[model samples]
Target: MNEALHVVCPHCDAVNRIPSARQGAGPKCGQCHRALFAGEPLELTTANFRRHLERNDIPFLVDFWAPWCGPCKMMAPQFRQAAGDLEPTVRLAKVNTEAEPGLGQQFGIRSIPTLALFRGGREVARQAGAMGAADIVRWTRGQV
Candidate 1:
């Protein structure tokens, strides 16, 4: 039997099953039908962030960032690169602190560009700072 991996449809948020071998080749979402990552960060707002966090079976690396912070701006690409490198193994989500102050308060985020790693609906670890892709990868490796 072919092993299937579950990937969420970025368009309609439906679950899609794909052959595991297609991980690197990349695949389109099955529902609304769009490239899952499609060169964009997964969007999270106060309304749906908790739902995604709780329901996602995979570990999530969510960045708490805001638009005006230069450090956060500089780390955006690195975050995306890390997301790509760690795809399937790890999922990435983003929250704009300015936009979701309540979440920031809940997480006790004191700085911009805070990285939180969550698994099984609980926070496993967190760090605050800007880092390169390789460094982020290393940091995540120790998390699990």
Candidate 2:
């Protein structure tokens, strides 16, 4: 028997039920018909954060960052690379702390470029500071 996984659509914010075995087969969203995994970090805001968190059966690696922070800007490419290396096992996303201050405050993100891993709708691991793509992949693999 194959278990179905709930994957949130990156393009339309729709929920898709995908079989675990076929995850690597490139599943499409039932609602918008878009690919489930986009090989890059999804831009998350207050409107879609909860839905993505609560809906996705896979773990989410979220970069809590701000626009003006140099470290965050530097780490963006690394995070984007990590997304390609990490999925379709894990979901990568970014949250702009400047635009979504409430989410940052709620997560107690005192620093920019914080990496938080969420599983089952709750944060399981967190890290602060900039890291390379290899480091991010290693750290996330260890945590999840």
Best of the candidates, TM-score: 2
The weakest ten consecutive residues by lDDT in model 2 span 29-38
Candidate 2, superposed: residue stretches over 4 Å from native: none
**Tens-digit lDDT track for model 2 on 9-90?**
9999999999999998889999988899979999999999999999999999999999999999999999999999999999
TM-score of 1: 0.82
- For each candidate, what TM-score against the reference? 0.82, 0.99
Native RMSD of candidate 2 (Å): 0.5
Residue-level lDDT for 23 in candidate 1: 52
lDDT of each: 0.81, 0.96
Error of 1 at 51 (Å): 2.0
Q: Please give the lDDT score at residue 24 for candidate 2.
A: 87
- Among all candidates shown, the one with the greatest lDDT: 2
- The lDDT of model 1 is 0.81
**RMSD (Å) of each candidate, 1 decimal:** 2.5, 0.5
